[model samples]
Target: MAGSLWYATAAPGPVLGPLTASVRAEVAIIGAGYTGLSAALRLAEAGRDVVVLEALEVGERASGLNGGQVIPGVKHDPDILEEMFGPVAGSRLVDTVASGPDVVFDLIRKYEIACAATRTGWIQPATSPATLEVIAARVGQWRRRGADVELLSAAETARLIGSQRYLGAWIDRRGGTIQPLSYVRGLARAARGAGARIFSQSPATDLEETHSEWRIQTPQGSVVSAMVIIATDAYTDRLVDPLRRTLIPVPSFQVATEPICDELRQTILPEGQSASDTWHLLRYFRLDPTGRLVMGSRGTFADVPVAVAARHHYRAVREIFPQLEGIRYEYHWGGLVGMTRDHLPHLHEIAPGLLTGLGYNGRGVAMATVMGRILADWALGMPGPELAFPVTPLAPIPMHRFNQFGARMVIQGLRAMDGLARVRDRWSARSAPGLSL
Candidate 1:
């Protein structure tokens, strides 16, 4: 199987050469994912000289490897965000993320990106009655904030998902999916067209702050700019110690089946909406434009074999969609996701004129795009109060060296809990009158 289904499917985009000479720009961005590329596009559009330094080809890492779900909101609940950041700032944060998919689709239209962009919406299915209540609370909270979300009954969810495994669901019309690699590549092309200098295979190995400018050093070149934005999320390096330590990188593995027959496709996600269940170790799935079923789940961060990790996802697919039994998987891949301590994205000003945005948990698609714009606005002298997420100081995680061990333990615990929850849910269902499936 191909390492990445996205790489096999997405059309080739622009090929930018590596940087070989020192350059100066008004702003320098490290990393070439959605956040960096989007920021470069905005900054270049504003007539500022911008340079994007990428360690590899754009979207070659997490950006290209992630499931293409364009989900809305950060990892935390809306009400919790409101309570943590207070009413005004927290509400703005909620609204900003709630509109994330709109921002993404708008960019696709404005740039005429050819990524198989779909706005059919996203569904969060509840695996049990307790999870259904959680989904209900989420739907109500978003609805009260004027979001176009609805709670689905058990029958409604089953009909939509073509699976009776879910108790209910929360459907958010604002969410959708995209060809992530193509989208990121398109953003890079747009940024270049807007006059942002992008260099591939040029990693920012060192950074230093001069009296009034930031100096970023690559292997073959260097960039001197008034400000710099470190947009590398899960792929952060030792060049940015504080930012790297703030996130625990976890592995997310995915597999995509060969295109199914049209008849079978019609019975699976018939509405073409993306869906994920409410398990602690969540399982997410969606149909590609060509009717291929793509599913993903958590994997080990260590050097565990890919096939071993993938067995879990394969079992999940069989359990959820028995009709897909014996289907051939054409691709299997995995990438790291930067999980923050609080399960929310962090925007921090490491020092004067040096900013960093990372730690999206797993919702990097829309949130990263929105965060790019936020970083651009901040680079353009926007005040902290005006941004959606609060700009705070970077805080390194304690005992950071043990993060890998901790992450593995957490995944194991979550999986065990999920197994127990399934047993309990089935027991409760059989005991309740008229609830047995």
Candidate 2:
């Protein structure tokens, strides 16, 4: 795996204890990424005995390798969510994910975690007239719900994003950015401080229900608990066949330039808002604490040279901001994003005493942390009817291996279409007036 900017710059995490013997806890969580660590913190703070078993060190997966944009809400808009899940459940779901950034920043302030959190905002810039309409609908829905969101004109969008490539954008003030690796490690530290036992290098080899309690078998130890929470999103393995099959892991790649001069830093992402364009194969860009321009996009499913993998991102920076020319990239990394068929995050009670919360699409930083709290709530006896998000059965996609293979071709096709759309929109802007909401 490539070393990410987060791993290269974030503070070192606490050393975890080894799991060499059998242990019993009220709840056992698998995969100590954002979800598991978040749940463990809440559970231990609530005076429950929680044990977390991680395959590797904390934040070694998506939680640590992500773009660090703490974007609020899922892929679907608020009204669409209500229509899809029905009025009551839909409304609750809307409120839950819409406050995702609040959940993350609140945890940071509460725990005093030093992750370089910035709440300037998150921007979704439109690449063409069609995407401009999509963002307009989203802004209207959110504004009606009393969210602090606004629509930006072409000039305003260009100012904040430091790019003339976008015609406009929708800004959500509640969204922000953070040092993701440091944040996840901070969560682990807080969970341990609150009386949770976390063990690293402990992969849950097998999980089975013996009698009424669940036993998770690892290499050198086992955990017997009444409730089991599978927080492993994209890194899920064969420990539970049905749960793993329910998600498709799509690889997202990112690269960061070496810290630029003060002049360049002041001109790019001037207000500190992270922005991702509206495209089928979208590209996101942000500035790290030290002024490194971080660009993220899709990476190939198969391994290739670092330069080859980061080729698209390099082109993005050049096309969007000509001033960034001659800047050298310093870091490149990739991680799998758990994408669902419907693009909605799934919460499943796969079996008695076994539950999972995954398929965050690309909004793992905020949504995954929200899932942790929800998982803790469910373990604390929250009934299904009272929960905001609906819990459904795991419906594994047919020919899962085939879908993963086919996604690569689909990504290439989208890339071509996106390029054409960009060129068309740029020509349209030069020929006539730009589009409006």
Candidate 3:
């Protein structure tokens, strides 16, 4: 079931009976993931009649099949944005993202959502010397931008992570983790409770623009709405062709162990913070409330397992924690991340009465939830720059359909280069003259 884990290992109690006939609504939202459901909740709360069309069920794709990392802010670094667009505009963007988590938390609390929400924070661990430098710089940049962040030394990092493989880490209290599927499903429930109509197992096949209204056709019915929001992310490529071209689908995989030793659980991530290494192809791991070590990483493997992409995650997890060697991986799964060419989110005003927001580049958990609220506000005629990200929509990658080959090549090449750098750093540490070496 697409939303099984999200509804706490049970399938979404028979998706809201499908839309069997024509309906009219103030807004029709396509895709019932975090973005769509969150927006539905917001719009419904404001007394607007909203209808959500989901292909399968709420949180069916990446929204539910993700690492559950509730990261704060947009994917791009502030310094990079500053260089591209001057400090003023860049600062504002950074400021908005810095406050995004609070907005999401407020909605969760207000709606009384039960997604096992936790604010235990997150740590950016450095796997190599170069990575340490980058993490240190990011910590400084975030601090200067008024984020509650700090860079930790190797000793402190080890104390926090119980792993000597990392050289240092960047700690931030703003970020956290969640049971992603649960959060989005909870949002759907909240939206319904607020008087929104959600039709699951219904995909918006055709979007018709008629006399200033948007008509979305599903399998068995249609919704004529004053406004429409395309909140599918990776799934948007199906209905919107240009979106498929602009947003590259990158696959991310995860695996979960049955449970670790009690001693290991007590020592490693006991406080429950989500942790990821500072690598382009990163490894993220966190323990569940039940002590299962759920681990994830970038890149696909040749062999796919029956359970949640287990083998790929197993290899990556073992590399970091050799103690877990030969352990059985009980849960395995994979999902596609809608990665933009420039590694930023996409917010497009496709036409009057129709808007689309997608391409979160793997940070969709909080970003999608927060963006949903903003998109709902935009549909209600909220004016200002906050409704959308300012970057002009660029042309899709040349021959984007052929990008799978390119993405694979780039990932493998980067991993090789990073491996070489790690070797050099290790050799240098062993050869140092005066100190312990």
Candidate 4:
């Protein structure tokens, strides 16, 4: 499927080897993705001797494999959170996610990270009338909460995106884009520079309480740590049972075109706006500096080359702009996203010295990095309130085992619904005289 695409086009990078001997540290972190690396960087900077154990090299997984859309905010709506967590906690969560991009960009600038970071902004384009209403409501909620957000008219959105397919959209300039793998690698290098010892291919096997401290048993050796952090996300192992129980792993896929002509590229999201369609099974796209169209979706890929997935993505490109067709595709790849039932991230204390953070849904680029900083602060004996953001263990979804199977069924159902909605919209557009195309 599309999974094979990533293997063909991934950048040449070092793959970490297995841990051959035992080691020790003050704090041992599992998984070297954004969350773990971010945590390690912050801790090392504070003079904490930290050791990060990774099953693979840094940015070997989703951190390295994504569409590179650095959009901000949590996956769920703010009102939905408020209804679920009460006004106080909900508002706090909203404020945290809304400002996450700033936190990320500031870190990049401060640390001199070489990732191709940009504040090009993002647009949630309404694909249909129903989805248009949803987008409009989101714009209203963001504005009401004092977010720097704007709702565009059909003409304004067309002018901005050079596509008339989207009815309208919600634009948030604070949300931007980045080269994901480079950013993750840069973070790891910074952490190492700050005195953190990061061991690749050292996967933690067992995390047990040893007296008052924590012992992380890895394939090569064991480290006795004052505290331990697990930030593996979807690749989270059975090292900790509670963590597996809290987060659900889901697969996400992406495809990239070779490069478009300057004229075509300029007319398609010319403002450097990352665009996502408003559908249950959504499509997101952005242009890389090389002029490649990196697009992604939520479903599994069929027996297609990276070119086929690229074609599918380009088809999506064509749907938005009929002007673009027959574009060449170069790469395709997929990654797993660890998610929670409520679409919120999970941070829980499984034992006295063991802590876990996972389930970023798909907003890991910014949220995961921010969470890493929070994880380090927690490790350094800092109080939760003292940390810039909040981290709490959410109640595990009841019958989570069954929910995994149920999740696939729900996705299939949503895909069907999305198809039906598209048909209905096309019919309405054809029959209604007052509906402007």
* Candidate 4 accuracy as lDDT: 0.75
Model 4 Cα lDDT, one tens digit per residue, 67-99:
667777877777877776677777777877777
What's the best-to-worst order under lDDT?
2, 1, 3, 4
Q: Which ten residues in a row have the lowest lDDT in candidate 4?
A: 428-437
Best by lDDT: 2
lDDT of 2 by residue, 1-437 (tens): 34688988887788996689999999999999999999999899999999999998899999999999999898888888898989989999999999899999999999999999999999999887767887898899999999999999999998898888888999999999999999999999999999999999999999989899999999999999999999999989989988788888888899899998898777889999998777777889899989999999877775656577688889988998889999999998989999888888999998888988999988889999999999999998899778767898889999988987777767777777667766675523211111110
lDDT of each: 0.88, 0.88, 0.75, 0.75
Better of 1 and 3 by TM-score: 1
**Preferred candidate (lDDT higher): 1 or 2:** 2
Q: Which stretches of candidate 4 lie over 4 Å from their true place?
A: 1-18, 301-314, 385-391, 394-396, 426-437
* Runs of candidate 1 exceeding 4 Å displacement: 423-437
Question: Can you give the TM-score per candidate against the true fold?
Answer: 0.96, 0.96, 0.91, 0.89
Which residue pairs in model 4 clash with each other? none
Ranking 2 against 4 by lDDT, winner: 2
Superposition TM-score, candidate 1 onto the true structure = 0.96
Candidate 3 regions exceeding 4 Å error are 1-15, 301-309, 384-388, 419-437
Question: For residues 2-57, could you state the per-residue lDDT of candidate 3 as single tens digits?
Answer: 32233345224325868899999999999888889888989999999999888886
